[model samples]
Target: MCENAAVTSTDGQQSPPPAPVVPLTDAWLVIPLFNEAQVVRGVIEEARRVFPLVVAVDDGSRDDSAAQAAAGGAVVVRHPLNLGQGAALQTGITYVLERTDANFVVTFDADGQHSVADAAAMVQAARDEDLAFVLGSRFLQGPSPVGWLKRLVLKTAAVAASHTTGMHLTDAHNGLRVIRRDAAARLDLRQNRMAHASEIIRQLGATGLPWREFPVHIAYTDYSKGKGQSLWNSINILVDLLFS
Candidate 1:
């Protein structure tokens, strides 16, 4: 759970105690990395500023992503071979949940697109609301500057996920999220790639955990764009969902 961060006072009265600040010790920020050596260090350092406990799962990177993450003050977990993002996440989550005493877990992308500030806020919100999970949404404050084709593809995927899972999700594949230990324990992750995103939504909906999405801003730099999913991947995801 979250611990109160700061208190505020109003007109001659203190507002109902604000949400508690989540201690970094009690939360584990799980970053799934795959050859993101250039930015992974900075990302780890930045995340460490808000959450001290960071576990970077190096998914069999061909470069020094693991070393960079380790040097950046993260506990590095590695897969023997190159597994997909979901596998990397599972490796990290299982390690954190089983190895550490962390009460909560967060799945973040190593692509440097997710916001640490948004993640910190979500942790506080999760603790204050006693939610099982907090999902980040890019559409909460209106549309982001995403490309039209990307938007169409994502929306179509989101709609498919919503209908399949019976959950009204504005964004189903956002990588920023906070998952409490209890809820995380209930998850039976099977997918190993991008399809895992939809699998998570389905699991969350099936479990009926108290969950909500908060607005998060994603910075789409050249590096992230280069590593992002392609338009054709949407078709692949749909096919995988149906058959794989």
Candidate 2:
């Protein structure tokens, strides 16, 4: 028998070693908060059920967002002044990219809409497919908690993004996403407004990032409906899209 082969008796009996079980660890869950002290705790709590590292960025919230987030067991990053959502998220991403050994990171809303379980699943899906980016969609699979006008606006924006960026994404503004370190590093989010959603699509196209789409649940509460983006904001987003 060769040295590499296991020795066997004349009766042809042989033994096999046990396979190793690899532990699961890579992704970090990030929640961006702007005066969302009411819902941030639950969001972080749910996120910790899956990801060991949960980061909450307090975007200059006048409320107790930073304290509450830290109390809820999340690594808290705060801004002295109120920055936009894109900037807050980018800050959190950059912090983790520099400070941790994270391979993937998820950008999730601080509101009570997103499911942490779904976020974990999205990370798993990204790992399985080896995707650079995974976007969560509310329209592709089933029902959404968004209002009619909001749905219409999102759909219209999705179409515009498709034409503008040559990408076939179902929902362009969903806040839930899984991103690889390389793709996140390549992203340059200059927009300080809602138009960053569209800019992200453009960046994905520009960088040729391998991305996929997955369905997720969104629970649009009365509070979220009240706090939803306005049509005027959509027009502003359009201007940003056109000019920037």
Candidate 3:
């Protein structure tokens, strides 16, 4: 009987008001999903609140990651076999380019390390600055919260990537990036593993498009730390870049 309560229908049934509609942005979030069943759905749901167009490429996850992504209102593309993260990313990007008319594509991490706010800001920066690419940098504002060893490896990788790709990047391996449609169309990622991070920088640098690094804070949660690459894997990435 409250003033704001649901109204009773003629049949004595109550009907509630419809949910409010949220206007979606023009950008699509392309997330390369693996066996992140515990967190992928939450990440996708949170992202959909800002950017409604989300595509999650499942790289043969052993768990129900694809289903969860679908439930979170994302377009789920499944890979029969367990391809690497690069392949999943390529699949997501291709899906966006071929299916949608989005103006920008954001590559977000499925493990929840990347911030949705940062992604939004990067997209805004691209629009305001007329940038073709906006890459995330953890070292722009100040030192990241990572340990000395991981920081050293990241710095070395950034230096090596800059030397090879002729693009100065402070955080070359950061997974969060906002790429305009024209610039994203030129990306042809061949590396199917961790080396794809460097490969992306190389390809983007080859485009000669205007790009800038935006300061982004990465949440080094226990879950993300568990899924982080080991020292040996980092060494392998360096070797791959040196040889490739």
- Point to the candidate with the largest lDDT: 3
Q: Write the per-residue lDDT of candidate 3 for residues 3-82, one digit (tens) a residue.
A: 45677899999899545544447899999998999998899988888889999999999999999999999999999999
CA lDDT, every model vs. true structure: 0.84, 0.81, 0.89
Give the per-residue lDDT of model 2 (tens digit) for 1-244: 5435565668998755333323336888778888988878877876676676888888999999898899889899989998898898889889889999899988888888887777878888888888899999998876776666667778888888889888897889888989889888888888768888887778877878688889999886776767754455556655665676
Better of 1 and 3 by lDDT: 3
Supply the global lDDT for candidate 3. 0.89
Error of 2 at 66 (Å): 0.5
Off by over 4 Å in 1: 1-23, 228-243
Off by over 4 Å in 2: 1-24, 228-244
Model 1 lDDT tens row, 1-244 = 3344344556565455565444567899999988999999999898888798999999999999999999999999889798888888888889887998888899998878888889989988999999999999888897697777767667777898899978788888788989999888877778887788888888878888898889999888887668565455556665665675
Better TM-score candidate (2, 3): 3
User: Each prediction's TM-score against the native?
Assistant: 0.86, 0.84, 0.87
Q: Any residue pairs clashing in model 3, and if so which?
A: none
TM-score attained by model 3: 0.87
